[model samples]
Target: MSHTDPDRYVTRLFRDDYPILQGLVASGRLRRAAVSLPGWDKATVFEPLVPVSAHGDHHLRLGYADLGAQIYALPSAPYAAVLRASGDYRQPAGIAGLQVCFGAPDLDAATFRAELRASLAQPLKLDSTPHLATADHGGCHATWWPNRTLILESGGDWFLALAFNLETRVIRSPGKSVFGIDLNADPALCIADSAGVARMIGPRHALLDGLRREHLDRPLAPKEVRVVRALGYASGRGPLEVALRDMLSRAEAVGVEKLDTRQLYARFVERSREQAALDWHVSWLPQALYRARIRLHRVDPAFSTQACHRHPSHLGIVRGRMFDCPLCTELQHRDKNAARNIQARTLAVHRHPR
Candidate 1:
């Protein structure tokens, strides 16, 4: 079983289908509740289907088990005929600007291209445009056997191709290697290796740190305590801290603002420049710990709030409290979770039999 071999294990593929799912629900073929698989007791599954047009009607599909089988078994002649009749199925004269992943070993580039052309030549109202020229410019990487391919959509767009290599017993990569993370206003930090050191820093921290130093000569206000808290400080509370506490209390009276002390501390920095700096430090601290090679795993935010770590038997118990793990559990912020998941994925790639 080589790392790149696809026959070693069961395979699953997830696709970006929110747009398509919305279309399907609009067309009245599926209900909003049917979007995800329901049997998992351990994790939440969100499978949104993408919209594709065929036979003069818009349809929703995902690049997974059943859908893959349907595409593979689709008769070439009829499929082409349907596409041609649709009038919207014209393939650009050049490369198709699309990314595709194939799960079957029998399928190759030529067959895949043929199938796609057939599908596109139909009189379907495609939700997306066919910009075929962008396809050839992108590179392709694949693992043989069960045969999984991820095609990068070229032309400098945000488009991406992702597929599961079913032959390997590995989970999806959590962070950027699988999906891109956009850090605009939110403070984000990244660590690249097992040593658990900071590799990339966001601008929020630098800005706050500079402000704190500049205000060194001025008397610290009570509000400044919240700012210092953002930096992971434990000194006495400042005026900003008291004001925030009061505001939170008022919000709670109105039936809003349910969060834990740690979360509150984590978000304090977002309140002010001083606080924002602190927020960066608190968020980055976990990454630093991971980079230092500490054997720790971050909590999956998806399950953290909804499920209890100590009582796995109790599922969907959302108590509106900050989720805390047992002493045996690892504490990780967002970036750390991503970094660790990527590392785990890379290790799985190397460990699979070649």
Candidate 2:
């Protein structure tokens, strides 16, 4: 059942599973439909019928086996059918053609061949396991069943996107303390703990630094731009992820300002040129917090920057990055105050969810 070579493994998989698939189709449990190939008009593939929500099982399922690796065998039929329709389903030439169509021009043929071969040997698994219980990353955590597997052809390249059915669960109650986080455009994240301690993580602007170093002299191509952006996002996000996880380990819940993009976009346009990196933080921070297994509250961000944490009703005077509360006669960083307000809002919502 396990073969080292991807081509041989896939070829044997098709040969071994064809009869079982045909039997399922004959029994009306699976249906056959035409899977269009590039030049073929009549290629057929089999797929299981969509079932009701209450159904206990599916024709295709995902399971972990042999050394904790995930496995399944559903997409092979359609994949094989595409190759068969092209007259080279199980042939070495077919795989070569796939490389030509999908592989990068500068990609080493042998390396791409190895990658494809290894990829085919491993198939996507479908299951309804709760994502929160196993939130170490990898796998889609949407609240739906029998997740989809996608084989996309974009920009003359083939891509695989497998969606695993991850069950969404209610966030556990915050136990020890709550941390309020304020993510600002200034490449800094301010955290305020319920115990009245406040701190800031970065003004590093990791994404800006990465991009500047990458595109120092020449303008990059579209593909190069994408690669740069992705790399930048990854580098910038690493520290933030570590910080969030560390905070969650100590706190029962973390509250964040529910930033409205329109407001953020306006602020970015007026005050900064680091707008591109903002997109990554705005979209990813909430999801990351949720997946960290702590109660994540998106508190209203309204007036957080303006209102003084020490005296809520007294609005603060903003002087550059510092805030001066008229009543307290002391100056504090704006982000620290915002973090405190976010923490207070989270506590309010947590106490009265109604």
Candidate 3:
């Protein structure tokens, strides 16, 4: 078991699959998938990676034993991208390669390493936990599991890591039924359930949800909103994380299962170059949900908006704004009703494929 090789090499990790995943997203092959959890609404697929939108320029708060630790952000593009891509996972699957080996080239190598150099830095105290300090900048700690994020030095002037998190890895589902979520740029997101109830957690409430609950802030100014949204497009905040967090927190108070919404969109649409970032959320949200121990689902997105659950009629064009069933007149929110119809269609096609 302790055998050593003169030459060692590692293959790609799941997050490495991100580029392909990103392509899948652009092609509309990937959609949010959901499997319900008992005490909460359905958890979308595991998206352990935090979208770059929320954490870009955010510091990494590190700790050792009980000594003080400091938060730092690496300036290298690949490092940031790898971290952004896998950040939400239970652990950061390590990254290793020749170009990014040892350290980021753009960074002052000595300065960057000095932070982790031990001799050059002072340790800070951790004073807050559960309830501590002010909400504005008060924070929690992140621990490292052996699950993902292991980097090493290669002998021939190279460094490499296989970045992936085992703790948050995707697994077969244990749920009985599926829930579908159809997305709209209007309200942001929607959810539909089996009992014919549709719900939504729109943008306004989502913004108020804040990065952390204890330290809520006033509404984001218009400019700030654009930046955050754009990050989701470029790096990502994995939009559903906040939405699910807000909904599940309320569901906890009511002692009801929190529902999750699966994102469904069309592949047949035109893409504007400026809107490329719009696709970032899809690749990362599931990993974020996985860290939260939630599940996400995806269904065939075609006509999810027009087709009514009560009838097979494409009753109205662009009919997803409000849920109005022409046959029985069963009214629902456009997104909510669409979610129900999506769930029905996805289940009919593949009944909980492993």
Candidate 4:
């Protein structure tokens, strides 16, 4: 379903007044536990919440709806007792609180609640938390911690949970942003900025097109030759001459197995020479073309690094290399910069009117 429905979406928030609830249960200090649902005012209790199957283990097995159930059952006991019972199971207590937000357009709340209840009834194992953060700029679902926050476009439909130290209400932030250059496809270079923004550059074809357009009336240079060579290597093709020579060698190799020694040798030699010429042409042609484009356009290499655009001086430093602007205090997005730059340029142009 489309990502525009609120009913298809759910967000759950969990908080606690303590830390390491699981350890407490394991040590036998906490006997039972329960949780409250988002709209509920009370907690449901689980008397003797520790399951028979959870013997000798400490954890909690509460789910989104179970939290509500615990609250609904809370009138029978004190709130603390309910919490103790809910957390009595062998499930890892690492999840101090959980927020379950769903974006399923066809979701049936009753069915979903039932599913949640069933899941909670089973023993729970501690697992890694998925990155899902909501902020004013946009939302992201992190697959891995640190810098790999995949920009999530839910169209408004999604589910998420948060875990943290119960006492402080603070989630341990994954310390650093992970940055890498993804160059396997389309030759685009990507960098995860320090502020959690990713920037990409160099789809060679597009860059080439831009270069050509930008430099339609200029003389090519020797430096341009180097850039073109670099582009050719990036595209996995060195030169036309080299490629032709390689093809000729392959054809001759196939002929050698036919037992026609004289014909094979003649073809092989002819093909080898042709292939060498092709390889030479391939190597130089792209370089020449690239040089011409650059000389004509005066294009500079595009830089893709993580940095806060707000403060361009604050570059992002990773592995002893300066990758992003350090001065920007906030996370900067790659796409946002294009808009920002455009606006800045527009304003400047209007102000100066050159």
Candidate 5:
């Protein structure tokens, strides 16, 4: 058993349109109560569904005999209509959801707490945060295979595998892969290594920007403006996902641990001060990295133009966006070089540990 799992896995089940077994939690009879499977006659129990992996790409397997049959018979369905996905916020732009058209049972609040005093080795920590997106509540039915443990939940049109597990460990990359990135600089995103080798990340904002111009350009009435705003809201998250996926693929290939970039927080602050209305140039890369278990670091991004890798001591002349030193031979793009220096600064800061 992995450390992420408990001695005996216990999955939480919430009853739909019913009191949450309040008597059990209040009576001090049980530390936590296992919910009753609706339409269950208290004979055969809900099938025990357990989560195998913790952080990245989790999967559910039934703790039963007919695993093959269960996998072949999961209630999955497709969307009824096709939307352009150009400007939809309620629906996922790139992510897909599992939907159950018909095969789930209604849940009930009726439950009996197990006298699990012997099951305790340590005090159990319960997370109170309610499931925001999909809850195993409401009138949406769920399927519980033989033996109560996990439930196949239905939320209106969406189907979800609602498994109860002891704990899950976050997946992480092995070690540090130090790289520098300059956002909104010459090549948009430039990742450079310690060997002075550099690579540019594609899937630039050009396509999205073109769509914004074509669909969201100004000089229009209320409806067009709404359409454009919706489009931006819908498609805005895609570029960051692309960049993050690209970064992850590269980082994994080279075992990247720390990604150093300019502190976008400060940039956003400065931009907000400059503009009357607030405009946020937020990147979901950091959040994505966090989810992917990658480390993120930042450095003062002002020195890229003033210095080059070849000679950190000598300041170079900035020509528009490029930087060059007359005394030294080669020339470097300001942002490109800055990208390298950013990584250097981060590594130096980390090594010194002031």
Candidate 6:
């Protein structure tokens, strides 16, 4: 058996507990729990039919055989309808969930639906059975195939999070390409691969700025403003995902600048304070990197833009969009240069592991 860092591999199973389970937790009978799934590589959390509160609900956990099946299941019928009904659904102005429809564009609906129904049958059986795994303290059981083990703890109420513990060793990438990314306040992502190819995902600040302007004069609720920015991020994600997928098709790892929010906000003020609000919309970039299964390295951002990638001692003049390096033959896009520098630094760190 491959050993896992218990802390890292521990996936949360439920969010809020049912009243009976909550009572058990309150009475000190149960506090925390752990489960062991020997061969499963993926899992899913479904919102229960009823919720404890608007915010807190008991969610169910089920193991998936693979990612394709999981994606096929997520956008099916009721779930798809709910996603479409969301204010942010399919909106370019929302968060990263704008992809209302999951799976391939031309996925065979009839075949996928049939397969989804068959796959769900076993787990859905638990709805009526409601089996408990019988830990040292009481714990809910998950209906998964192959093998299962459940353990318990005596801590206070857990966070309302459903985590899926994936064994890191299970998902192995054959590619050896490394990529470095630079995220700009323009709400754009510039990627530089080891092969020297560089591409920009989006200069999405305009849409966010437009959103701010549209809502700036209104006396709307914070949710309304947030929804607009979320749509922007969601829309931005389409290009970002496309870029990442293309990069990862030949890459096993990715490197990104370790951003300092204080410096970012300060830079915003230097540019124009009016556009600073764009920061919130683009903040999803870091979260998006983590969502991928590939190896990730965060390189230091100090001097990433100012120093010349060709000659470390020579500083580069960073104008609005271009970098003029004294040692370089021609002008380079500031973000792309920064991305290349980030890639080089990441490679250095990996080669000489300190």
lDDT of each: 0.28, 0.46, 0.33, 0.26, 0.34, 0.42
By TM-score, who's the top model here?
Answer: 6
Tell me the RMSD of model 4 versus the true structure.
29.8
Each prediction's TM-score versus the true structure: 0.20, 0.48, 0.38, 0.16, 0.40, 0.49
Compared with the true structure, what per-residue lDDT tens digits does model 2 show for residues 1-354? 222211100101212344444455577755554443331233343334533121111122212100110111112222222222222112222323332323233444345334444534444223233211113322213321222332223222222222322222333344578888887756557788889888776455433443355445644544333323322333343445455545645667778776665567567522222332343245334444444455778788888999998899989888889999998867998989988998998888887887
**Residues 1-354 of candidate 5: C-alpha lDDT, one tens digit per residue:** 122221111212223311322332244322322445332224222233232111111112222111211111111100000011112212211122111100012311111001111112233223212111122211112222222233333332111223221111223345545566655422445566555666654323343344334434433343323222322222332333344444554443221223221244344222211110111112233423443455566566556657876677778898886789766777777766776777677567655656
Q: Please, what are the lDDT tens digits per residue for candidate 4 over residues 330-353?
A: 444443442233233323333354
Q: Which structure is stronger by lDDT: 1 or 3? A: 3
* Candidate 3 per-residue C-alpha lDDT over 1-354 given as tens digits, one digit per residue, 9 for 90 to 100: 111211111211223233444443355443333432221232233222322111222222111111110111111122233334433322111111211322233434333223322321233222112111112110111222212322221221111122333222223234333445555554555655544566663333222223213223434434333323222222212234343333322221111112232222233112211122122224333433334344555545666667776675655344336656566555656666567777666555454456
- Tell me the deviation in Å of residue 285 in model 3: 4.2
User: Which stretches of model 3 miss by more than 4 angstroms?
Assistant: 1-177, 205-239, 242-281, 288-297, 317-320, 323-325, 352-354
Reference-based lDDT, residue 317, model 2: 86
Q: Report the number of the highest-lDDT candidate.
A: 2
Tell me the deviation in Å of residue 145 in model 5. 27
Tens digit of lDDT per residue, candidate 6, span 90-164? 222211122232123443434433343343333322121111101110111111211122322223322222122
Model 6 bad stretches (over 4 Å): 1-162, 165-175, 205-207, 221-223, 261-293
- The candidate, 2 or 6, that scores higher on TM-score is 6
Which residue pairs in candidate 2 have backbone atoms (N, alpha carbon, C) closer than 3 angstroms, thus clashing?
174-252, 175-252
Residue ranges of candidate 4 with Cα displaced over 4 Å: 1-101, 129-354
